[model samples]
Target chain A: QQQVKQSPQSLIVQKGGIPIINCAYENTAFDYFPWYQQFPGKGPALLIAIRPDVSEKKEGRFTISFNKSAKQFSLHIMDSQPGDSATYFCAANPNNTDKLIFGTGTRLQVFP
Target chain B: IAGITQAPTSQILAAGRRMTLRCTQDMRHNAMYWYRQDLGLGLRLIHYSNTAGTTGKGEVPDGYSVSRANTDDFPLTLASAVPSQTSVYFCASSDSSTGFDTQYFGPGTRLTVL
Candidate 1:
């Protein structure tokens, strides 16, 4: 079974607007949630990550908001730009584990 | 750094054939992983090795196999090629000594089976 579920197969946002992608996991054992960004033909790269111990984590224009009790998390892209358009994936990791459970994905398109 | 490198950028095989996808890392990472990426399934781990000579099966390991012969190499093998096995394969490595850390992925190898 897929442990993590992501919403909005695709998203479109105007430049300078905020774009959000939501995800939820069934396993409460997950301790780390990381969001990845992938460009066409490229592997996904870490955009931002948040541990369940914290409510949120922000770096540059990317922010990860995690709700441990709700078994949910989201990635918010602030001031969306054309270059920021890419596929976003949400993943979960259990403590001391090296493997990650990933969500389907959300393709973001920011219009100029 | 060369990071992780997966050989044969892409491959086309027929059913009943045996295929192997090669992965090498220059980072000397103790952890290596093989994952398959599909359109709707995101990325699923097939196999992983925490160190050379030891391997573990991940969520989707039914059709795949992997081996970590040395610190720099981890190869994923398909004993019998099948149509369903066609997908982009990615190899990744991470420096776990710094704590469960970020993984660096390779460009990926696109495979098609007939």
Candidate 2:
């Protein structure tokens, strides 16, 4: 079973617009949530992360809104740009485990 | 710092043949992991090592094996390759001292089984 589920396999947005990607996980033991960004033919890189204790975290134009009770979290890109176009993946780490459960991924495209 | 490096950027293997994917890190991290990325499936952990001598299986460890002889290298071996084993594999490492830290990923190794 997929531990983490992500919606909208792909997304498209115009420059300066906001692109939102959402993810849901089934395991309540998960305490750490992180987002990764990957370009074509490259490995995924850490974009931002959040702990369940906080409701939200913002880094530059990237923001992560987490709802521990709802078991859902979302990533929002403010002032999206074409350079921001890439595949985004949401991941959850079960407490005390060294492994991370990743979402299917969302391919985001920003049009100039 | 060459966080991590994977060998054989891409490879093609015959069914039933044996193959090994190599991963190395220079960060001296205590934790290393191997993951396979497939279309629509995202990344799934195959195996991981918490320290130099100990290893553990992850979500998809069937038909695969791994060894961590030291802190820097973790190799994944496929006793016999199958069509289903063809996928992009990635290696990652993190500092275990930190409760939960970001994992640094290697470029990737794409393998094709025919």
Top-scoring candidate (TM-score): 2
Residue-wise C-alpha lDDT for candidate 1, range B1-114, written one tens digit per residue: 888889999999999899999999999999999999999889999999988999999988998888888999999999999999999999999887767888888999999999
Model 1 clash pairs are none
Model 1, runs deviating above 4 Å: none
True contacts kept of each: 0.74, 0.77
| Residue-pair clashes per candidate | 0, 0
* TM-score per candidate, chains pooled: 0.97, 0.98
Q: What is candidate 2's lDDT per residue for A34-69, written digit by digit as tens?
A: 999999888899999999999999999999999988
Question: lDDT per model, in order?
Answer: 0.90, 0.94
TM-score of chain A of 2: 0.98
Candidate 2, TM-score vs. the true structure?
A: 0.98
